[model samples]
Target chain A: MTSTTAPVDASTTNRTVRLASRPTGEPSAENFRIADEPLPTPGDGEVLLRTIYLSLDPYMRGRMSDAESYAAPVPVDGVMEGGTVCEVVESRSEALEPGDIVLAYGGWQTYVVAPANQVRRLDPTRAPISTAVGVLGMPGFTAYAGLLEIGKPQAGETVVVAAASGPVGSAVGQIAMVKGARAVGIAGGPEKCAHVKDELGFDAVIDHRDPEFKAKLKEATPDGIDVYFENVGGKVFDAVLPRMNTYGRIPLCGLVSQYNLTRLPDGPNRVPSVMQRILTKSLTVRGFIQNEFVKAHYKQFQADMAQWIADGAVRYREDVVEGLDNAPEAFLGMLRGTNFGKLVIQVGADPTQSA
Target chain B: MTSTTAPVDASTTNRTVRLASRPTGEPSAENFRIADEPLPTPGDGEVLLRTIYLSLDPYMRGRMSDAESYAAPVPVDGVMEGGTVCEVVESRSEALEPGDIVLAYGGWQTYVVAPANQVRRLDPTRAPISTAVGVLGMPGFTAYAGLLEIGKPQAGETVVVAAASGPVGSAVGQIAMVKGARAVGIAGGPEKCAHVKDELGFDAVIDHRDPEFKAKLKEATPDGIDVYFENVGGKVFDAVLPRMNTYGRIPLCGLVSQYNLTRLPDGPNRVPSVMQRILTKSLTVRGFIQNEFVKAHYKQFQADMAQWIADGAVRYREDVVEGLDNAPEAFLGMLRGTNFGKLVIQVGADPTQSA
Candidate 1:
């Protein structure tokens, strides 16, 4: 398609969501305030871009709290930081043209002025542009690096992951299967469970919501679990503990279930029991963020994941909301396990669509 | 000192303490009953040995209970299993000779008949015979393999270990220092704490019994803990958890404090918080039994430890009880943190004493 490069001045209006207050338990609509602001211009070595897709992930919950964490908390009255796929509209640098699509950390805003070098260009010919914020980006890399580096699944072993239909867990299960291991996925309901087993090609899928979930897991894996990719720790983790085999590896990636908990759960502390299992089973329970392995594994992941995607061995699903105004509601529902896939907001549409 | 081979008779007398009953909490004198029986003769390819020193460790506490564990429960009314340094009394195989000191899994009994291949012969001239049960055997190997393999301490990093005067913890701290990492030792009393810091050359030491234990730990480690060699689980662990640095490695070796608990301790369930820290800090909490690394790292450990001992780089202390009748009480004391150093029962006098 032929495209004309026009120097369109920065728009007068910019939509943004400000962090109204720090969340005490579950974040609400009141925690975010939608406002309009004057658009920002591209400065030296910078580009003015409009967000096409804004990604919502579980790690954002940690950033909302004022508690000590690996990363600093999102301050009150600031836009929530997130990954976004954007189209470069105005560039002050010689490196980029007006229509080039790139991956950006633009936060929850319709328009942002970011340094050109800070954004990575994404080719429209390879995969969908929105995927740069979903499957082929942070979430996909998280699963790949954490599983191979920490989980280290061997062939014929059973690999189990909770939140099986989400971006990271789905990638983890698929990658485990590709490595010749049996992937057993645990999800919240039958639909996600079915998607995990049928679409994602997991060997087995169990619904954690079922009353007989533990028994089902036991029946599902005749050989006990060798690797458990921990994402949603709570009752699901409790159920998975006794089922882990000797020398089993648990790559603890997240604890989405406990993110909203304001107080410690009621008594009969299971810490001793957990320690007992660790000693008896000789288990390796490692917690890791993907950034630790990015230096060593990122290049390999790009090559392998791209090949897997092209060969039809790996598949992904995305759940998209229509507007920037809907982001807060979409994110709140995501924390409640209402979103079916990698949730993304369609802040704007592709300019190439009209060509 | 000329050695004479003792004739093995099928009807030789043997005395053993059987498990009278499983203890509810702390083991009492009534929990053990001494019995007299005829000694077992060596079969083909077997050797008979008289126990010299039986090693007492926290793991034996698990064997006393009927609960499930990594290994099968020691059968009720059976002689308690343990590691021992013994002298061969009768040899049916050419591999072993009478008066040869060897390391054996001979249990807590006066005499044992087992295959010659099951025991490793030790050189009495090279080192003290009891060293096989303390600084150069299973406990020492446990410390070395777990710390180096799982903990992987880098230079300038801080390593914290509890029960610092015990064989494993003492070795771990010294090894961390050898790797150029700061070693912080945690023990139950002032005397043991002093021994860990003053004698063993640990960078810092904290008494877990002190009312300001946590405050003292904070003062000791200006930089957060990088490796926590977890040997004692309880309030000591609770204090250490928050102080762990990002990407911390925890080698979960033994939980001496929780071994005697009949039920879970009363408190708010801390598993969620543990999982949260695991996720946020990117910690690696690995539980291991030393036998797992025997094939991979044992040979190197023996060479390195032997040289360290010979050069006085690694020193060990032993608390010996004089008779077999005192073993149960000594072992009970070891579990309760009453016994210092490596607890060993001297069932008989060393024949080399005459030399």
Candidate 2:
């Protein structure tokens, strides 16, 4: 272990959680290892950051596998990648200054050095810095692009989203409401369902864990679903399939339920039935990654999202854990739908606050 | 059977094929029965017609099953529904005159009566009367709408269509080529594949039956496929899936291979794998019924297709059966991939043609 007496500078040491092994099912603590190493120095046009809040999302499960994916897999012995809100501790560029709070992709580390252009400076007075790692960042942008671009929710139509209390789903429901569409939310329990309906103002919210979940969903949207922003594909999707209206659009954003599966579930293959409905209904089922629309929609998204957040047209919730060591367990819980809101790890206190 | 001799006037008799039973796998001749009955006089604003050509399409297979579909199932003893080209023998409305050839949904019959406004008049001088039942009608419209509206072929891109020798598939390839996109066609055998490439002018063609079919597809498309007009889904779809480029668009018009499936195939469900690729590659798979775009694009389609036919920019072939007795067998053969080109039953010869 490094001595605490060492000066806290770019050459000083830091600790990080590394990918110890690839996960086959629900990841275990054994899949990650914590290691301490010397901090990297800021080169020209670079800055050193001290992590404040790290965002944990479902997409991370994809990064742990060696399978071919939109993005490259995290290598063994490397820090697990993620979005973070950090403070610049040292700057070698004219664009940034030390102690500035900014949004970064510094991953599961206490400190990181990255090119200055890669980080965006966050205004502490405008909104909480932690939000830049959640609602004002990737999750919010994902909901905006997937819904408006693909879902194309027209006025008076019903739009349904699953995992409804999470950052993405909650934002999707609120945005649909803003667009003058009916929003129906599906969550795992009564509490989350209540949060979606009473707090987030969804037109209807159903607990998917209930035995009568399918029936509830059917009754909730009597006019049938026009846009299903698919985030969880399992029983939730199976129920929604039959109720899709003609010309229905499904913007498939994620499939969290099947992510940790070691092998395909035993089945009577449902592909034919799915295809049959698609043909008869003239449905449009499109899958998308948020980054694909960034060049065209990102600037608009940032401006609109910031306004929506400021005006309370869009609301977000966060479940913050205090220490880096707890991320592995919190992430596992998140995959199992145990998290109540967006899960974030507060790696350390904001450096601007006096100890 | 009723007596064949009857007055060839307002009280003339009509003969029709009816659905006797639902089919199991391939429809058998026993599942259909022909009936002869007296035809009543035309009502006010209705016209009487003599059937010249009746179209036989794959969609008829769905009508033979009791299972629910986009449209209602054919009643147990009703005339098998179909599009036909007919000559007006009598008229009670200003829209028609005797000897006029028109497009009508007159079903499988020798003579029938319908409101004059329900049919579109066809000029025999502009093209063969039988073309109204094939290339210049529903099948051709299906191809035009599905490709241009949903597939959105761009110049210099590669467009792949399965069932390439079939009516819809052939048109899709031709139109893609006309729009400056490279067309790669997939058909069942060497003869059909040759016809697709040589006769239709597809840039490249491959036989799906070849053991090296997938490898051949990769070799033919050095640039990955940008548009996939999906009409035949099965092993053919499996082969084309991995070859799809980023942001590829698939306009799924049909899935002929899975229509007769009695039960789901044994699993290691491939659905998850399919969804994963959709997210990672950002591919768009949309299912459509062509009629959705008809109100906006139909007039343009008819004008453009007629010009293409006249200049040889588009060519069409038909497999016509001599009599209605062979219609059931021909249709069954078509569903099994044994018939080549558009399948039409020649119910009767044109009275205007001198023999």
Candidate 3:
């Protein structure tokens, strides 16, 4: 394989979704703008990538707002930020060649030009190419590192995670199972709950939409929760907190339930009560971004996760929304817990997957 | 010295302070009752301890209530629980002899018969015997383990602690300084603020009672707080949360401010926002009791603290009340931040002190 750059053709163009405006509470379609522009040329040490699949996540809702976060928010009229699986169309670097599939932060766009070193090459023979943006990518690593490092689920301990049908939470539960911990999942609907319990192989699954959500959570975790992979905050947190055992751990990665919240809820400011619980229970509540562990754990995560997938110890589902045009609606649906699995936008046709 | 048992005299009586009633909010004189009981004799492998100094701490306030906590609540009409420095009046084991000073959980009584192995003997030649209940014992060890193990103060980083003039906070600041970190202290009044800054040698000290406390805290931690030894919670926590640096750690030891609260305060529950801050800043908030680190870090703590005290890098002050009869009053004062330093009742004469 050799690096090659194709001549810029006037017929080729890039379609992109940009942030039109910031949302107040829940985002509407008016917050996004679809535009078409001429394809970018590959520079020295860079590769021109055509996006195959764009991931839609709850964290993107956070990136839409200008609130203080671990990552910078997408600016108005800028390409909405996200992870994507792309194919190298034109390369000017020795590290990557034309037709090579790679995982890149090409965001909500049909095409991108990135440094070859910045994008990681994905071998299509090992797994589906789309899994690069789902199970074998950032979301999977988020669950892997946060659960193992902060949550530290010991054998026979109960590990609970909400959004069990989604990428991060699904992986959290399954990986906890792999480590000999009893994985209890909390999902919003009966179908998702069943999938999480039957297919994902979690020890227990509770439907968060049930009126007895708290009681169900309590029932599911009879021995009490030792590790809670906190992805969805709000009432789920309220339910899980009291069920936490002594010396329990909370690996806080995302709070999707509160991401759309315009303001804090009315109450007696229960932060102190939470602090009181943390003190009396000897709990550890740690917030982390998965990237913090990449330098140390990414290689190990890839190897262990690959093995788990091979042995059928781990399973993942993808809710693929067709076309770049459907991304905005799909993303909104994901925030509302409508998406069933690792939600991704099939931006363009995949060459590796046989039709 | 040899193990010996004193003859129990029929005329000798033990004076005790028992929990008459549980306090709803602030404990009062009515909550405690002073009584006389017959002296207990030492059994085989047991020793009789005559309370010389009774330590008054904020945690005792929690034990007074029937609320669920890390430790069980004191039973109604039971002896008020506390740590005490005692003189072994009779020993039936080879570990201790008569007149040997030891640290014991003797409660609010003048004398207690405990298993000889349970009490820890203190060397008066190394430090003051009263220190067994203060700087050289539990309080100091709490500061050492919580700060070093959990807080993990790094060189040139800023470390903040509240109740700076009190036993735990004072040692926390000094140890942070010993670790080459900048120490910021928060205390209630001018006297304590002065002592924390001038005498205890904190890098900076703030008067928490000041109307501009939040502003002062921000001003004190110019580079932002890398480690916060959370000894006081409530408004102090609210102020410190915004000032925490990314990847900061909080060793949650005590919530002195909320110990007496009968009910939670009103309006706009901020637990989510606190979680949001934790997420954005990648913060670690862990709660712990000092005894958790006893097996792993206590020996190192003793060696390191002894050297620091010897090298003049650490200093402590004790506010001794004249009699056990004054303990309830002194304890009430300590809760209100009226009593400075480590509050203790001199139950009997300290023969080791050359007075």
Question: lDDT (CA) for every model shown?
Answer: 0.88, 0.88, 0.91
TM-score of each: 0.96, 0.95, 0.97
- Ranking under TM-score, best-scoring first? 3, 1, 2
Winner by TM-score: 3
Which 10-residue window in model 2 chain B sums to the lowest lDDT? B1-10
lDDT of 3 by residue, B1-355 (tens): 1111334342377878888898889889889888777999999999999999999988999899989899999998899999999999999999999999998999988899999999999888998888888888899999999999899999999999999999999999999999999999999989999999999999999999999998889999999999999978999999999999999999999999998888888869998899999998999999999989999988898898889989999999999998777888889999999999999999888989888
DockQ of each: 0.79, 0.71, 0.79
After superposing candidate 2, which stretches have Cα over 4 Å from the reference?
A1-11, A351-355, B1-11, B351-355
Candidate 3 lDDT by residue in tens digits, A1-355:
1111343332397878999999999998889988778999999999999999998888899889998888899999999999999999999999999999999999988899999999999999999998887888889999999999999999999999999989999999999999999999999888998999999989999998899888888888999999999999989998899989999999999999988888889988888889999999999999999989999999999999999999999899999999888888888888888899999999888999888
Give the poorly placed runs of model 3, Cα more than 4 Å off.
A1-11, B1-11
Could you tell me the interface RMSD of model 3?
A: 0.6
lDDT of 1 by residue, B254-308 (tens): 9988887888988799999988888889998999999999999999998999988
**Model 2, position B97: C-alpha lDDT score:** 93
Tens digits of per-residue lDDT, candidate 2, B205-297, equal 999989999999999999989999998887888788888888898898898998888877878666776776777788888888877888999
Residue pairs with backbone overlap in model 3 = none
The prediction achieving the highest DockQ against the true structure is 1
- Decoy 1 TM-score against native: 0.96
Candidate chain B TM-scores, in order: 0.95, 0.95, 0.96
lDDT of 1 at A107: 90
- Chain A (candidate 1) TM-score to true chain A: 0.95
